[model samples]
Target: MAPKLDIETYPGNIINNEFVPTPNTRHSINPATGSPLFKVPVTRAEDLDAAVEAARKAFKSWSTTPFSERAKLLLEYTDAIEANRDELENLLTKEQGKPLSLSHTEMDFALSWLRAFATMKIEDEVLQEDEEKIIYSTHPPIGVCAGIVPWNWPILLGVGKLGPALITGNTFIMKPSPFTPYCDLKLGELAKGIFPPGVVQVLSGDDNLGPWITEHPGIDKVAFTGSIATGKLVAASCAKTLKRCVLELGGNDAAIVCGDVDIDKCLPKITTLSFLNSGQICMLTKRIYIHESIYDEFRNKMVEFTKNNIKTGAGTEEGVVVGPVQNKMQFDKVKDIYAQIEKQNWKTALAGQAEESRNGYFITPAIIDNPPEDSQVVAEEPFGPIVPLLKWTDEDDVIDRANALRTGLGASVWSKDLKRAERMARRLEAGSVWVNSHFDVDPRVPFGGHKESGIGMEWGIEGLKHYTNSRSLWVWKKIFE
Candidate 1:
């Protein structure tokens, strides 16, 4: 049975282990229905200040607690979330417009991150050790850390930042996207009983709130997941306080389908990922490069698969593969691309209607066949259920075209020939390169971006260090004697 989307119990911002409401409030819109799901507190300057101060006060104790102890509390918090998993999933689907199954997947993804963080610890590194002298380095928490989460995968990405920030001994404050703040605030509500006061806080606000959190003097670091333009603004705002930033920005990821690949085996994976979350994912395969030898056959098959297998509707509907675009801003952006498609008279293997007809923000997936490399549909990250399939003949030429984009978040090469795929994967400019796979991220592995895709890393040991400051210590043996 599906859970109810009642948010009456989880109200307003979470500060110092209590729900703090503001006079000014805003309602979260459901992309599936274009209706107000529930009212969310519009965090004011005072609320931001209080949340920051609370985190600062909690930091004194949280930073000193043993890693094992902190991990224990986080584990309990995970349990609390598990107990209410159904509610979180339902709320997420209503707000973010992903299918209910995907919502469950996001919850599982978030819990896995918390569990992984619980098992990992940051220990002092012995740089040099001898009878004469000993030298080592320690990772100390960087005070209060802020996580600015996006709407696409609110819980999973929020936990991606929260787990590292708290497990490493830093008190955390989360700012969920205004478009999808319900589940995040509810998560914070669940945390009230598990984490100590001020150890974990969540504030939901409008556009103004992001600048406040980024520019806040009390926040020592910020981990942001959003568009490249917004990420730039975040980094610039944090520059004033010289706060550490871990940005996972946009990706014009390219998926190269080789002639040798079993088209039937790989078609489902490509189409699913290309339009997953309505293509709102930062690491989604925005550009597809198919070998000319099999391009025609592959394109037709992909179009047929999309026509036969994919269905768009509200997430609650059974057997719906794609949901509405998460919000109006994105829906409008994709609509603009539709205009571009008409203006240029480009060929579309599968075309969705551009006109707004449905009561919701639903968009059928579109696939442009053999569009020019410089066209908007191919060049820019549409971030919708739209993609371009281009033809590639020469290996070197194809690799260069795939790497031409300024953003390099993720890329993949598909081919049965292991040596050939491996060789091509090495040349693609991306933080995560895969062969016969896309978006296969693991908690044990470090995930981040290269070039303008992002700065710094998240997950794994490297990501944990981003929330900490490194300190070196040297002790002479003679001094102790």
Candidate 2:
């Protein structure tokens, strides 16, 4: 069971370094308990205007501040988050419906990312230099960026936008999803004293908030992480202003298991990768393709593991390995896919029922064995605990099937044979490919999807450059002389 929370007292929008009340407020429900968790201000268009103006004002000084000085402030922010790590983690678990342990890991990643960004410096580049002319390029900050974060990993994704935007000298205003807004809003409140008046701000609201932020003339860039449908809307809105945008959208990641691999050693890992965070992560393995020779054995092992080890309940429950779906919307989405599975009469290797007797939105993890290629469980990203296991006879055939989807965010190949794994990994179409592992990301490596998965990159030097624009400088010597 989870501790009862007082959701009424959570902070509202942060503008000009202070928590301000808005014209209206909305309540966010706890996915694990199916109850109201907190009430956040529903930021209207006017509130967005105010937040944008505040960011614009702060950018004047923040953009000009030395990179070293900005780094110091970010480090300070990292320290503050670390100091309050436990409290933040608990809050995240309560609202986000991730296990407390996973919430701690999210905080850990957020801290490491902030620290990494703090130490990085993008120096001016000299494109050409000669006795007669010197040409150099400067990466200047794009002012007043709006970071739209999703609910799955709100704090980490929010910081993913913030680290790059702030380290590169742009002011940021974050719009957290209404599903999970408590921790992010609190983070903004904590950052008030660390950053300048408007360097970092957070606003929470209903669906309207995202459009207002993306379309606002005052915003120079929009960094968004969400579904493909919503990402398209955000892009269209930014297109009107010709504002820069970085979108990390949806992914139906695939994991291929080779016949040559050891099933005993690999089955445990594969199950963990598939169902981690209740399958909410964008990069998690949604589709599993196994070689025909080992498909039956692999399927049996996976079913046994999931049946024995995978348990779903409230996030705060001590022995629960998986928590409830993040919210009712996602829960219903998963249920719809289950309905499709039932309609198709797909072979179910393992399935469990939700604890409707309890108040939380709990659904048992499900594993479907070899659904049709065009089935919704196989073709679409379920983004839930439901996954399909397909058998493939040929490597080339599986590669083609894996890449056939509209989304190409991430994929993995598992085999004990190093050379074989690498060769297959190269052929799969994705931004990130792993051998024998999945969802292992580092702050230093660049992460983004190919095709419809996302546009632009995040978390590396390439990510930092996205928050800035390039300006060329040229000096001609003695042309007249």
Judging by TM-score against the true structure, name the best candidate: 1
TM-score each candidate: 0.98, 0.97
Q: Residue 474 of candidate 1: its Cα lDDT?
A: 89
In model 1, the Cα lDDT at residue 165 comes to 95
Stretches off by above 4 angstroms in model 2 are 1-8, 354-357
lDDT of 1 by residue, 1-481 (tens): 2223355554679999998989988887888887877788999999999998999999999999988899998898888788788878888898899999999999999999999999989899999999899999999999999999999999999999999999999999999998888888888887777888999999999999999999999899999999999999999999999999999999999999999989999999999898888788888888899999999999999999999888878899997878998888889999999888889999989988755545688888999999999999888999888999999999999999999989999999999999999999999899999999999987778999999999999999999999899999888888756
* Candidate 2 clash pair list: none
Question: Which sections of candidate 1 miss by over 4 Å?
Answer: 1-6
lDDT of each: 0.90, 0.88
Tens digits of lDDT, candidate 2, 1-481: 1222233466668998988898788888888777876668988788888888899999999999999999998988888888778888988999999999899889999999999999878888999998999998989999999899999999999998999899999999988898988988878877886899999999989988888888899999999999999999999999999999999999999999999998989888889878889889899999999999999999999999998888777889886778888888888888888777667898899875644436777778889999889998888998888899999998899999999999999999999899999999999889999999998887778889899988999888888989999899898987999
